[model samples]
Target: MSDDLLNAQNDLARALVEARLLLPSGVPGLFGRGTVLEDVIERIDALVVRTAEGDGARAERWRFPPILPRALLEKSEYLSAMPQLAGSVHAFDGTVQDHQKLLARVHGGEDYGDLQKQTDVALVPAACYPVYPIVASDGPLREGGRLVDVFSYCFRHEPSPDPARLQSFRMHEYVRIAPDADDARAFRDGWIDRGLLLLRGLGLAAERAPANDPFFGRAGKLLAVNQRDQELKFELVCPITSAEKPTALASANYHQDHFGSLFGIKNADGTTAHTACVGFGVERVAIALFKTHGIDVAAWPVDVRARLWAP
Candidate 1:
């Protein structure tokens, strides 16, 4: 990160805080949002839904909790790929003596890490993780496969001063499961265009480009290389805090039989289903809107406001 880019991010963060659009929680990348900011997020989400509807996407809607079964995470092999970003849930399931020890440590301002035990649930890392199991449980998919609309609050362990990189954020996703790889690839490719148009329609200067996940370690680097080589992911990016290094506000990904194999999802022909998903970072889009047009929503361009607010 260049000094100029860092300065730009800091300035934007301060401006949003001063405008009461972001309420600092004394933590970087974690803050409460003001009503206007939240309203913008809501409008953006609704606009995506309307666009999906207009495109004849009759997806099954699902809203998931912020956490998922730890077993599912293990089955998905997410820990192997990006354990550094995973947030595991832990709790104090102990005897009375252990409780007394915990309380004593609390009073003495000491660590009580030994007393807590890992729970069955873990914070959801992505909006689409929970959709695979449900789709699998329904048995083999039909001839054409399925489309699902899912929304969830996602968590990652990254702590950054850049406001665009939030530790906890909402993701709105549309996932498609198909029997053929071509269909799955087509879904992702189409979304790359649609997502770009949607953000640009919101008066944002957004661009679409091939991208890769932040896979960890040496082995993960190889995986990321293969992913990029296969053109498995693409992101719609816009300049939120820094124009030089834009933030990815949305992504279109083609997961070829990865989730299907793990979750036992299959097609009518007894082959693993190929999957693709397009996800939007709701809060990031709202932040991009504020950065692009001005913090004051009422003073935004008439056509942009109409697109977001008009009935």
Candidate 2:
């Protein structure tokens, strides 16, 4: 990024801090949201729920903890696909002698990294990861498959000065499990329009375009290219930080049989199911609203306020 763009992002970050919308924790990309910011986020979430209801989507709501079993994450192949962004939990599982050694190192101002051991649980990388296993366990799907509403606090290892790119964030998603790839693709496509409409309803200048995940390594580059070529992913982006390179506030992805095959989710005919999800970055959307309509929610346009805050 150019210096000018960096400065712009920095200025926005400082402005948000000054307005007390974001409480700094002395860590980049990690913040404790102020009450006003939290209120905006909750209102946005409620608006999403209302929109989904208006669309006649009878989605089963599921909420999951921030961490999932490490084995499950491995089974999902997230570590292989985006190892750079994965966050694993670690604990101090040492004997008394080891504890004494750790204490000595701490007192001596030496590194104590070796004292911690990897735990069985890892931070959830996405909101939809936990849904597939439960769906699979419920046995074969019915004719229309299943629609689930899931939300979770997700974690990625990226630490940045850009407030839009948060390390710890909330993702609200609606996942569809279908009997075939065509169904999954169609579901994702429909959500692309819905997502764009929802964001635009909030008075955001949101745009939809083909996109791909930031897979890791050289092999990941090939995977990303294939994803784009297949047009399997689309993002609703807004210029919260910079217009030259907008941030993705929402994404729709068709994960063709990847989760189904791994988790043994099957159709009524025993064929592996296909899956798709539309995810909204809750904090990013709130940030965009604040950036677009100013920090004061009371001052937002009447129509926008009604869309979000009204009954």
Candidate 3:
């Protein structure tokens, strides 16, 4: 590469490092043992599964692979919600001949293969996108649409100095659907209190307030204002690092018929569906828990500590 190109690449790498936000991946993201992060992940996943129990809602195994359609993103208003936060889906597509050649070279550990681009797909910015397609493909929804619990590894483009605000994060989202606008709104409204209750049970000092999407441009500003004023969304938050303020650890949102209309999701009678979601940021909540309980998990409040490790 030319000197200018080399310098540009260096700058980009440096910029990424500065954005601790993307540190979602580990120096060893697979951390185990008595680490604060490990404890948090365990309790959080348990809560999600336990919360799902007795409900007819579905539960799928969790894993991460970045792949989804561009169309679905548009329908969900994801791009408009946070344009820069979306991560690009990538693949390595090589010709048959190229593959054979690379295989031959690697046979001797030569490791000389060009990583040319394959197909372009969008990175899963949220857990619910893939689920939406799965639900919609069955044609219009049956009866009351559907309610699903999904968890996904998501990516954002920002870099936060705080490792907790990583560029990549795990999100656990519960989506509710209904044929009527009132039903959907009720579902969204219900989660606000429930989410706060869960937070308190976990021993965090949490509160609810209207929130924004970090959208861009003048239109985004106006959209945010409208959403806040209309109380279409709310956040469950508590201080993660400092007592001065708090971060949004989770959100309850009402998408109305926006997604249902776009993706052709319909009711049993075939009318458009109404959608709502309550999302949990597993890592961010972990961060909050650590701050609330201290790095020393053993020393946490008796009830909270027992509940966390209880059988």
Q: C-alpha displacement of 95 in model 3, angstroms?
A: 11
List, residue by residue over 161-255, the lDDT tens digit for candidate 3: 45456566778888886778898788777778777877899889899978857887887898898888878889988865444446788898898
Provide the overall lDDT of each model, using Cα atoms, as 2-decimal numbers.
0.91, 0.91, 0.70
Candidate 2's residue-wise lDDT over 1-311, tens digit each? 78988887898899899999999999999999999999999999998877677445599988999999999999999987899999999988999999999999999999887899999999999999999989999999888888999999999999988988899999999999988999899989888888899999999999997785789999999989988888889999999888978999999999999999999999888899999999999999999999999988889999999998877
Q: Please, what are the lDDT tens digits per residue for candidate 1 over residues 65-184? A: 999999999999999889999998999999999999999999999999889999999999999999999999999898788899999989999998898899999999999988889999
TM-score for all models, in order of appearance: 0.96, 0.97, 0.77
- List ranges where model 2 is wrong by over 4 Å: 55-57, 107-110
Lowest lDDT block of 10, candidate 1: 49-58
Model 1 steric clash pairs: none
Give residue 262's error in model 2 in angstroms: 1.2
The lowest-lDDT stretch of 10 consecutive residues in candidate 3 is 24-33
- Summed over model 2, clashes come to 0
> How far does residue 76 in candidate 2 sit from its true spot (Å)?
0.7
